[model samples]
Target: MTITPLSDATWLAVAGPGRPASTTIGGWTLVGEVFNRHDPAVRQIPDDDPASYEKKMLARFWGRFIGVRLDGKGRLAALLRDPSGALDCLWWAQGPVTLVASQVPEWLARSAGAGWRINPARVEAALHDPYSTSGDLLIDGPAAVLPGAMVTLNDGIVSELWRPDWLARSAPALSDDEAAERLRDALDQVVAGVLKSGGVLAAEVSGGLDSSIVAATLARTEPDRVRLWLNAWGPDATADERPWVDLLAAHIGITATCQPRATGRLTLEMLTHLTLGIRPGLAAMDALHDADWARRFVAAGIDTVITGKGGDSMFIQPADAGVFVDFHRQRGWRAFLSRANIDLARWNERSVWTLIGAARRPRYTPAAIDDPNPLLRPRIHPEIARHPWLQGIDDLGPAKRRQILGLVQGCGLHGASFQTEVATVFHPLLAQPVTEVCLALPTPQLTLGRRDRALARRAFSDRLPDAITTRRSKGEMTAFYGHLIADGLDVLRPWLLDGRLAAMGLIDRDRGDVALTRESLAWRGGYVDIMTTAAIESWVRAWERRLPGG
Candidate 1:
């Protein structure tokens, strides 16, 4: 990808293929790839109020874009980022000169003159929380144009323009069946938009609700244009998902190419291909496998790779506490207690009072933090530790609000991090329209009968098999994470002992190694902490090699 500086106030980077449509409307110049809508006629560009023009545009538009309108004097009037934040927008400002680009490295490279060095604090934060920056590239203090907002750089003054809270609107009053039908239609539109890109579409089907729904919908709707790829973890692994994979594939009537689970230690050779700056935990490792699969798609003439990534966050069921509150508020104490007992039983809770206490807490909080690695907590920069990781949004329902905000602020960042150069990965479930409908769903519709993701299961139950639609437990990739540390002491000694992260005082080598050795079999957050720290070490090594004198 080439990052070309369009001007002091603007820059451009093209991903995948096709040129970004650029037009001069009125006295303003707008550049972006408009999907699901025609290029905004210059006449559509509001003459007196540029901010209103953005609102009007977003009210009617859908697609991944980074757009900026310039005044006749070549001054930036407004900058727009996609609502779903699918495309990354990295920008750094120095004095009056503000530089922006789609890729992080490009932004960093240009901002080097602005005294932008790798921040040890941010780097360590990335290791501790991969979803740090809410999926925006925030390692070096550059601001990302996150979803549902616009930035204006006029007269060297930068201001943010926020669009209305469209996603959090109440669902049209409809019965469960009607809601499901509506959801199915929205998903169809999102999938159809992805297919419009043309060429063969290959979906990742792990037999999970999200992937199964995507793969099944595509195969059922456009069987000729879609193919399925299942990452079967082979026979030795207990509780493999291939049975469900096979069941879904058989039901869809399309043969799925099962790619055996990836096995191998993280090799030095693989680290050499790592992208610069801190990436999400095990991102490079995940990319290694994705790239391999992408090659097969390329050979098969498939250009678009769709996955079920954002479905979990997007089609979120209301939080248990929120559910309890809703029941208590809408019905009576008896009803709330009835539902509360069911939840307690399902969760195997120790006490109903304890669940009740937790349910009473606020849904959104500045302190609703992640369980950071204990070892890493001491090393984290004090300021970073104290800073609020997630911002609170007021317009959304507690459950849907936090879920979508988490998606945009946290998991959404991972969307682009897992992409391969050969194939374009599309998360149809994460599309703005799709997610909007998901957030608008009535609470009961989403979690009816105390079932999680109930709306999704009901929406496409007809297209999916019972095994997939009814399964409660989510698929795990412990096998994959375990493989990273499968070699134990020898595999990570060199990197962990004296690598950049340890050298920066961000991690204690002896302690990390001991933790890894002590719990090699435990594929949980401890494993993630070790893997993420190691991935950061690998990234540091790659960046060091690219220095003027290594």
Candidate 2:
């Protein structure tokens, strides 16, 4: 489980540490690299002077990489997800990434040999018994370990490994206007950062609550500076998002470029984009035009891009959460209910529901599901119950399920958004602030009974049209690209049918194809995973072609 994070532009590849406890499984070794950017205990060797001088000597024949930035989030560094903690994935994936994994396993693992000791029962027990128990126990190794056993117990790493960045710390207090100002300022910072880096800020205005608000708010700034990008597919390809971007740009009075899906130029680069985006789950399959457009934007003087990625997750109320809360309270009793736990209370009906729903499984950390190890990640929901890797495993439980879902969408984006900006910074609702508010809010406040996603609509009501703000059904960006599937599938079929897909080596492509045919584009089953896989496969081919030996 070697993790090598790549900075192509800087030409740096930082190979991180590995898990001290995990044993080998098949050809791949397991590593544990807990990347808790907020964890206070974790420390790095101070760099009064740096290392990596010798490794680059051999790399000199190829190229050069700058010094590694391990302490901060200044640049995009892939967090290693392997249980063993090594930087070998990059060598296999054929890229440069930091394998910043741990070198020690607090608990003992099953003995080596004996047909992979960690069984489905162990996987289930780990996921179910969420609460940590501290005493140690003798862990029976593989059948071979019937005699000798490794000491095992609830170790801190399990809890520490999955901890979300949200619970870390807090920002200084601010007034309502100040909070709004903070968001706006973050937007400007992203814009300026991009501009300074000779990059353009690609504002992904999905017409949904988050991006729409971001686009509208950004419009109030220097509209000309922000380039609007939309994934044009589904019911209305040419017509989709035309009016919103059109009206917003017109009203804001700036230069807004709408980069839609193009007929030609679909290839493997999208895979690179997916990896860069850190969202290989969906974008890796289709609608690569969005990422292609992003790369184009970068080439066109847009080094920094700003997106409203975590906005919806932040305001989980007024949607499903609101609905959940409404169920418990009658017409009048709603106002009287106070949280059984926390003292802080906010009267905003919308905000309450939004936060609660998004934080349904508060204890379940999204980080666990958002593993960087490709074999263990970019999971598909429909296939989760059926994945070969999941053989003999039981349900992950409701709380854990919620956390896993949140991470797939939330944490996955945390990494994937990088594809847009060579150096991307999510503004307005970064994960830190957003996840806090979301988790604090109770279930009742999150899902407003009648007014689903109301908080978002109300925020942007003045700016967006009723068509988008109040829309119920989400469209398919991939279905719109159905025009190409028939033809593209002709190109995609051979690859899909290839041994790489059939062998379930790169991914469980066989199951993925089955799900792709049945599921919608949004759900991991639907469009998201399909488009992602398509893009990644193509990219892998191209990446291979671009490799030095090739």
Candidate 3:
């Protein structure tokens, strides 16, 4: 059985390549792969012997705890219950076995030991073992221990495989300083690895802490071979990335060209939407359009793009909400209920939605948490929660850390970014050495909230200029000339107003108006979102406008 939850959900349960994993177990449409979940019920077993009033009690318990049911043929379907016998979690329904997934100490009381296979490779093709189909990104979970290997999946496609060895933690782990040095060395190895395999020793330096570290390490190793490029809306007159790019260039003392070009919201007139179904209207479209920016590096003897894609998500922790939660937990419930200097309630009301709402004209409503929210636990998705490592996301306190783990773990919408420019994009920070140890280690060693990426700053203290290393605040490289939104609005006027964006089946037409307005007013949205849309539209139109069978 294929174990991985297919990235393209429609392909699995919908059409592509799989058997319908369903039947009327009790009367309800026992959706085999129910609602983006990939688990199955094997069977159900009973617990107690017949006592005096056992039938009535068992019937009520089964109905409530397990959601038990009967088909016209009297086939049974019910949820699994905990030891005290409560409807705690889903059941792996098989004959005579009542398997339960409880958050407490014990689980799987009487059922056949539920088998879980988690495939962790971001893409299954990378796993190299065609026999293993779990499709999870990390083998099982971050803490899941597995052996690295070279396995042949199919003829002609040999892939490298590495699994986490959590047991290694039993031995002495590298000290914070040692860990930093080891990480730098590992990064250096990756740079050589990429180049050795006829790939590129390149990085997309966003001047943020993440990419800056990569860029600095790479430059120190091979400054002469290094080529740097930045996405600029216009020339230096607009201050388009000239300041930071110039700083980096001078630091490396290399002829780093910022390659300032004008691939605004509507880059090419005829071409509109981009590949991977992104609208040239969003920030991803900008990257998709700028992906051609990669052609220059390709010409400059570079073949791959090493990037800090998951760096921010994996490396940094969000502002502390734990202060409030902890303060409440220790001091009193009243203190916790009150908003600390920082709280989720305030943030949701302040930053993202507030600004966007003002310009766009809609009020924001927050999602209400009903049951013991997934924010409190990982078992919300029974199948996904199987790997003990995902439990880390749960154990993490405060909502910010939880969100960060979610972003790092669940890359469900990565393709929406519309990054087709570079051949290969590597998030080396997600490299096993980096994720398992470097990130999960002591936070004070790396960063102290808004203090700084202390670990990176200290390691490269001598190499990087103080301007770069000491930088606490981050910026959007395109923020300088993002004012071009008004200009792009003029250019894309026909496409947006005429409902062409919708007709193309790319963007949600309902949202097209608001998105167009955001672009028209030069009201800065988000760098990621705006660029995504711009890139998608340009690619789609370029392909469509390609000389017919040229």
Candidate 4:
């Protein structure tokens, strides 16, 4: 860990080799990886106003970073976080001093000593809405510095550094081919930039469109840097993607290491050893899978693992009536009714009349902070705290609003929070530059008012296999997760039924018993709730054991 003093009162502490070294640029101390859009030219903050500084910083640079500047008296003036959330910044006030770090610092825990206890509100919030990006920490006290926001240290005021609405308002009018070319350029630059930094990289070739595109891009950019191509297959045909993987491997002229899905089966012992974060992040079922892959990446001395994680959300992959709404609003009734309506209808597999009605009065709602688990005690569920990005989206068309919400939801993705012990997992698609370009495109252009990720297919068509670019079906892991939950019942049932969560009255014992039965497990949706509950239970146990009196 490197600690750099910004002022007499404030200091910056950064850890991990994946994080770039802190550098002083124009009197501001910046930490984490930052790339200046205007290369070779440095822009200085015009004044001490946090708002103005934030605006200038947003327009000039993009990456996973945090910046801080000092006042004349050698005190911290302002602090800003990157828009992509590629790095985490969490802070809590410790009397006159405000403690800040990427994650909860161990020193604070040691300071609290035996007095530590899990934040019940955060636990309830997580159980209520596991995917929320609210700034609450699982361990009480510390609050997170949300992505694309800034803070005034003296006044303790926080404000947005970047807004989603700005991107929407500035969306350029471009033709299909023009938009595709621009997107292609953005994807290439982001991928190439990461490669230029140099590292022992591995790309996940999941045989899906997104991962395949990433793999193809990596291969074309700097193939020699990518030492491995990793793929995981399942026993069931639905979970297998070996054929597509092989096709991509052949196209890229590289061999891929494919392993059985069962190699990472969830086990009770694994849960106990999980490196606890600010919250219960890893899906209980995916705990072993992530650990297994982490071990492999570490053993191979891989520095980074790139995956197409945010493609679904970023590419607007969901076929919904929102696309029709966006088209109708933007292109006028004549164009929408004549061409877009039919195209969207065909895409959604719905009749034109149904699509029209739904578009006129879209029923799709944002993801609510409510748990579907029958075992959860609803009374303790916390009040819904909407993420900032979801605000002012009511004026947006259904498709665009859902698209923004999808991005917001992606912010809290398990992979975003989960880090391998040593290797850094990078989602190049989620980089700020690529995200801004995609967000600024019209929804119709993004999906062609028909197929999901239509523009993405057009963008990388020349480089990737035709089968992968046009592939509609995705590998299903429903059976894999179902079997995992079924097999782990003996361990999961006792662990959850007699766990800390139940003792705290957060779970209904009677309901949990009914939900964990073989009869309940037969239903496809039942396993998800069970797995979610088990995750929370494991988190509670892990933290309790770490606290003094437990």
Q: Superposing all C-alpha atoms, what RMSD in Å does each candidate have to the true structure?
A: 4.9, 14.1, 18.0, 3.4
TM-score of each: 0.81, 0.49, 0.48, 0.90
Ranking by lDDT: 4, 1, 3, 2
For residues 66-163, could you state the per-residue lDDT of candidate 3 as single tens digits? Answer: 22233344333222121111112322334443222211111221123233222322112211211121222221211111112111111212121212
Among these predictions, the greatest lDDT belongs to 4
Worst 10 residues of 2 by lDDT: 143-152
- The Cα RMSD in angstroms, rounded to one decimal, for candidate 4 relative to the true structure is 3.4
Candidate 4: residue pairs that collide: none
- Tens-place lDDT digits, model 4, residues 1-550: 6666666777666566434467677767778666766331124434665476567767677766777777887766767778787667776566666666665534546564344567776677767666663345577555666778887777778888677766876787899999998788777877876786667998898899999888888888788898889998988998899999999989988889998764444577855644456556542237667766877888888988888888987888775677777776776666445676887788778889876676566454423323387777875755756667877777777778777776775665533223445666778788777788888887877998778999999899988889888888999987888877777778878888888888888888898888887677785256666776677777787666655565
Candidate 4 backbone overlaps, count: 0
Candidate 1 or 3, higher lDDT? 1
Residue-by-residue lDDT tens digits, candidate 1, 1-550: 4454555645565655565556444434445534553333235446686566665566456666666676565655666676666666666666766566655454345435344446677776676666563444434545666566666655334334332243345346678888788778878877777777676777788778888898888886788887546455543545367778889889988787777765556666555454533343343456456566756776777777788777766666433545444444334557445764476336533366644554455553323434556435374475554112244445344555556554654333344343445666677787766766666665545766365677788889999998788886766776555656656547566767767777788777666665656353453346655666666677666545433343
Give Cα-based local distance difference scores for all models: 0.60, 0.36, 0.38, 0.73
Q: Tell me how candidate 1 scores on lDDT.
A: 0.60
Error of 2 at 70 (Å): 11
lDDT of 2 by residue, 378-446 (tens): 332222121111222122222223422343344334333335334344444543323433333332333
